[model samples]
Target: MITDIRLRSQQLVNPAFNDPKELVAWMGALQGQEYSMAKWAVGLRLKKPDIRKVEAALEKGEILRTHVLRPTWHLVVAEDIRWMLKLSVRRVKLAYDSYWKNHGISEELHIKSLDVIVRALEGNRYLTRQEIGEELSRAGVIVGDDLVGYFLGRAEVDSIICNGVDKGNKRTYALLDERVPPMKELHKEEALAKLAIKYFRSHSPASLQDFIWWSGLSITEAKQAVGLIDAELIKERIGETDWLIHHSCARNVRAKRVIHLLPSYDEYLISYKDRSMALAPEYYRKAFNTFGIFYPVILHNGKIVGNWNKSAKQKQFGVESSFFIPGIEVDEGELDKAKERFRVFNKGGND
Candidate 1:
């Protein structure tokens, strides 16, 4: 049986971290290139209120720009990205750089490909991989999709290239000089320490497994972080597993009957390896259903009781929700009752 408090901690302490300053530092950009891990961290939620706060945080330098951790874009803190990449690079090598080498991507070719992309984008402001490849082939590189796309992606990581206008079709590349520089640099160890502190601060009352899920960092990095952190924090051991809570923040942690319409990869839903606290075992399959991998869900009183979507029909607007856990199970009445909320929430959408 999942306790409401446990689930709240899992999703972040009920009235969750209302300060966007606290949460946005963990992720990177709004639009990421591949690296779903980075994309997932700064997920796109369905609610305007939720998005507004995240965007506000982006405007602040609390989140910095560094291609340190994931190969692709991550909206990590200005300080965290520098050290995060250094700490996690070896793991990245084991995962990608090494694997890419096996696939014929020598260090020389990697450098050459970036040159190819930069030469292509030198004069032209926006160009696709196909366009970039044409120039690369002319310059004597293979210019295949593997070469072109991967090279362009890495160029973004190198902080020389980034996404630009769609050109009425699909993605194109632009110089980072053209795109606004979103963040600054921080010392490596300072970044790591700060990242750990941010993780524990924003998402309090969490275990090491939770940090592993949230930052996508290895156990070594996670434990090192847990060791270096210094703050008013409390630990609660539920048997062999223990969770760290921000003593300063969680002091007045009050439980509220919340209906957080979290987005697909909302931090609360995705930032944990073992999610038993917020989601039951049986409902796991239902959450990550086979319907092409849908976004996770909204929790009524901490347990994910249903899922919701936005829609419009006949010029009238409405939000639809399917309750997973029966309402009678949680309450004596209608479980996960969202129909009335949707009706009220969607009225302004039509007019």
Candidate 2:
């Protein structure tokens, strides 16, 4: 229980640091599969909650969202994107090989598609996914319905492109080099050590297995990486489980009495291989569905005690929640405070 408290505190929700780019860099990569919610994930860590601040950072090219770990979209800073892609994209590419092969996407076609995309997105231009697909079609490259997303994902995995600003409701793509300033690449071992340090420091009280699961690195490779950073880390035994945390992380912590409305797919829940510490095992099915859809959760003092959802009606915000902690009296004031945080976040602070 003390371990869980310290781990949540390490998430830096108070945002003693404010820059979204710095926050993203510190965490290595934030799970960004759900674009809008991902923005809120970044927002939740800020001293003043505002989702638009994250969006503004995206527009200014301070950060780049691309396919990094696990072949899913992640919000990563410009400086770290290259080395991070170099470290993890190979495993992702190998995993996606069968999907690409099934769609008749050949090496020649992939190269041709990249060339077309590069030419189309040159000169600081940002093209929508549909626009990029249209450009490929005009070039005699067949990007079928299913092939469109796979092809674009390949461009990101290959580090040729990344998500840019939004075009109305649609997302646009930009040449990564044009958006992000040039950064020196790191050697493989150095890169591994850096990544290990970042992950543990930002998401501490984690295990080697958790790092492997989050990074898509093999157990051997993960072990080697963590070994490189051993001097900077502290190991602890919580029950029978051995956890690795940064030496600087909080110890001698007590369970927090605060409540947090954590977004779906937030790194706190998704970054670990085992969630039994933050989420009770029996209630996992209640918070998440069998199809892997994680609803927004009401986190009370580091434990996921319930799931919550919100809606907007005529500019009025409403938050609905269900707590799993039995016989606990409902504190409307506390619930309202949690709701206000989300209210400000969702409204982008206009409220």
Best by lDDT: 2
Q: Assess the local accuracy of residue 95 in candidate 1 as a C-alpha lDDT between 0 and 100.
A: 52
lDDT for each residue of candidate 1 in 60-110, tens digit (9 for 90 to 100) = 444433344544345554444434555665555455565566677887987
The C-alpha RMSD of each candidate to the native structure, in angstroms, is 5.5, 1.8
After superposing candidate 1 on the true structure, give the runs of residues whose Cα lies further than 4 Å from its correct spot.
1-23, 26-73, 77-83, 98-102, 122-147, 156-185, 289-294, 312-317, 327-351
Question: Which window of 10 residues has the lowest lDDT sum in candidate 2?
Answer: 5-14
lDDT of each: 0.55, 0.81
Question: Model 2 segments beyond 4 Å from truth?
Answer: 1-9, 12-14, 312-315
Q: Report the lDDT tens digits of candidate 2 across residue range 178-225.
A: 888789989989999988988888888888999998888888889999
lDDT of 2: 0.81
User: How do the predictions measure up, each by TM-score?
Assistant: 0.70, 0.94
Candidate 2 to native Cα RMSD, angstroms? 1.8
